[model samples]
Target: MKTINRFFVVLAIALLLSNTSTIAQEQTRPEFVTITTMHWNMDNKDFKMEDWKAVEKEFLDKITMKNEYIAASSFYLHRMTPDNTEVVYVQSYPSWEAIGEAAKRNAELAKTAWPDENARKAFFKKRDAYYSPMHSDEIYATMPNAKTMTAKPTKDMICYVRKGHFAYGEGADEEFDATSKEYFDNVTNKNEFVKAYYPMAHAWGSDRTEFLEAFFFDSMADLESMFDRDTELFEAHWKDEASRKSMGEKGAKYFDNRHGDYIYTYVAGLAK
Candidate 1:
């Protein structure tokens, strides 16, 4: 009886240790994203696209390439938006603290790139002339389930983003995540149209309740096909009309009606 008791105690300790290790791994998951949206100062008489592109290229080649903390970067031009001049810049960091480290390193690299103080000022001035003062920034924790379905291409890709806010309730987050993961695994992962998909949630941002999902496509035509495929997948998953309506209602309750959709053309050269 004493030997049996000792075996049970050993098993309990092993389980506890395993659980602790899992928690630590979860806490240290290495992925964070920063997104910023800005509008171009199109009315500026001296703002020239050719000149601005040169400055941008210098920034990317000199600054972004040397920044050790920046795992990847991408620039996107908004398509079919109310503001035709808007641009979105996204950077991924291995950890949350890496974001701040990248900014410091980028500043140092800029100085090295333009060693002359006057030249640096002129370069930055030209860069500043391209963008308006107004901008919004958001930070998100990249979820573990994100998948890259294709090789990274050296050309443009279409990005579709859906942003939504959640309504907090007891156990609501767990319920929503379980259902959402099921949808991603059973439907989205099965869909061949989207080249890549990433899901993220507010980490350190203005809106604490926000959630974002982004889908990538090789071209606009592929994006159109993805939409049609989505409807078919939904019907296949939730066969009956009543069952579809029920699941939709359940999902709807988890989120606020406020959401935004954005389409962008990802620039190849601007990405790291």
Candidate 2:
């Protein structure tokens, strides 16, 4: 996104102070994740969903799956309430060095997969034809409170992403971490409709105040139910109206009113 509005989303990240904390953090997430927002070539009449999947899967099976530096990668197709032409591809790395290492390793893997000079060029040309030349990338630092997927998704899953910005910094990092963790444990963890969740903060991006969160669901029906489930969970956890109101007031201090909601289809075959 050239404009700041066309940017990336949610979470309180924990900055580790010691090796012990770093070990525990790795169990939940990688040190960094890069989300690339790219557009589909609308004028490409020859494009087919099946063909695109086949091409991406070939790259996944040949390079990404075999790449040790990359922890995970996936693609999300736009579903609603945003530019329909957009497709987001995200890749996570264990460390900052791994990000550069993955690129070097991928190059090596590509050469091995297509050794012939002409064949290599031909393969990439076909792959590159699927997307427009313009694209944008943002790198995020993963936070502590994440709901991990138990298993790989077997089909296209409904995914919702929310991006918001931190409006204030009056509270200490400890306070934000405690408050966010409490809510994540109570409401987010108990919400059955939320199949998976990943919360992150802006790392190397245009806007430093940006926060991003990704939620996964089995279907659109389940996605609809997530909000209702969250309300039920929240009420049950808070119990009294006073406590619920206090919780809201606490969170509202850090977040601005502005936010963007995006729905997408999480493609399964192309995941790595």
lDDT, each prediction:
0.71, 0.78
Residue 144, model 1, lDDT:
48
RMSD in order of candidates? 11.2, 5.0
In model 1, how large is the Cα lDDT of residue 163?
A: 74
Q: Enumerate clash totals for all models, in the order shown.
A: 0, 6
Give the TM-score (vs. native) of candidate 1.
0.81
Provide the lDDT at 101 for model 2.
99
Which lDDT tens digits does candidate 2 get at residues 176-254? 6676667778777787888898877788989987877888999999987777676666667778878766665556567
Best by TM-score: 2
Candidate 2 C-alpha error for residue 6, in Å: 22
Off by over 4 Å in 1: 1-30, 46-50, 170-174, 240-246
**TM-score against native, each model:** 0.81, 0.90
